[model samples]
Target: MSVKISLFISVIIIIVFSAGTFFLVSQQTSRLEDELLYRAKIQSVLGAETVATIIEEAIDNGVFSVNEAFDTDYQIFGNFDPPKYHTSYDSYLDRAILSIQDKFLKDDNLIYAVAADRNGYVPTHNTRYQQSITGDPEKDRVRNRTKGIFNDPVGIKAAENKEEGFQQIYHRDTGEVAWDVASPITVKGKHWGGFRVGVELSSISAAQTQLVKAMGLIMILILVVSLLFTFLYVTKAMAPLRKMTVVARNIAKGNELESEIPVTRKDEIGELQDALNRLRLSILIALKRKKGK
Candidate 1:
């Protein structure tokens, strides 16, 4: 009886605790994602605005021609894996866009900071991704990616979004997921491409994995502790019943004064104890009357 009751209660403990643990994990995961995305949007807007201001200043000072910077017609330059392209306007942005990206790359979560034109032409990229190509298709695709058109579905949405900040997620060629938040870059009220800030969620993913493991460890402890507690409690609770079983067996064998049943509890077990005491008293009284007669 003790073993059966302990096992049953332990199962209930697992079910209840499992449900609560998973709910907490799901909520926490969602909160982490929301916070990460919020920060991404802020970074995108700030970076985009900063780069746009730099472009306008250079144009105003006559450092670079605005005509070349906004050129829609591009020329393909290299027969590389991504097909590198060139435009007359790309030279003006080559040097001006690097400083702002350097500042944004200080944060560990930030993967890349770059701006693309309306046609998804990237004149410049972060230096980290601008290493010299090694003539390997797979390697060059991830590294040394510059002067290329990023007109993929997600890239097109980012480059063409002229209204406000927007966010999207995609897998990088480096086998990691990134959250890309973009804000349109307008130069002197003219629409340029958009600036994108990429956020790598590896840290958040690591934290969530740790949380799940900790929860699993907690559940194991609960199971162990609960089973131990239930076993001890059921054993202690059923002790009196076991003793009464022996006493009732003795009484049935005509050992009239074998022992007295104590009514200690007010529950059904106590009622059984009281009934046994009454039966014992009735037997003793009948024996006394027979002796006198």
Candidate 2:
């Protein structure tokens, strides 16, 4: 076969293999993303249940009233707002929620573990967000929130639906992406609020990118090996054809046979070699008869 034909066949093989590899990698990455989201949702649901249980227990023990714990009225001081006070029961509940948040954060994938009341008031937040406000609006929005109101659409949706769902949010300042899953919190058969668990997707995205790059590298290596083997095999297989072409040219120029065509193959090449030998013998016999006459 011509070099061009050989190279074309190799290119086609490479294309087919590369396409298959790409499809498989894409599927694997998609599954991984789904698993990550699934785990996030489960965590959110569990956290919501735990918070609900704590609140219910506090109420049953008569340590705090449900109405008092969820009270929205803020006690305003004269000029400067004095530090807000929490009953011992409320403090106990807060510590329990904080402990849950800390445990979740240890996984590194979890971004936030928080619960909001029906009115979107977050009574407890992650330990990092529990820090005192530094008077920075942007920073305070993320941190320093015990009785802070978060009337965002996500919070309201979770409270209204009382079902587990997913959400995505982007931070413009940091260009951060957050994947959130929310589940409703119920206390004593009453809809209290919801618990939200957020996962930062930047790490997951980076991991996916790395996986794609690795797959691409493997494809390149396989392609190179395939091409190399194809080139060598094509060259070896066509060497006998090249020899036959040269022998035919000499016979056409009325030159004496220099060497017999090698018939080492048991395939079509061997058959062609036998036919050429017979033709050469017939020509020699005809020339002898003409000379004798």
Candidate 2 — which residues are off by over 4 angstroms? 74-90, 143-146, 166-175, 254-258, 289-293
Weakest ten-residue segment in model 1 by summed lDDT: 250-259
RMSD of each: 3.2, 3.4
Quick one: best lDDT, which candidate?
Answer: 1
Please give, for residues 119-185, the per-residue lDDT of candidate 1 as tens digits. Answer: 7778888888888889998888888878888898878888998855688886776787888789999
Return the clash pairs for model 1, or none: 68-89
Per-residue lDDT value at 139 in model 1: 89
Lowest lDDT 10-residue stretch of candidate 2: 76-85
Instruction: Write candidate 2's Cα lDDT for 58-95 as tens digits.
Output: 78888778776565565432221223333334456676
lDDT of each: 0.82, 0.72
Cα lDDT, model 1, residue 116: 86
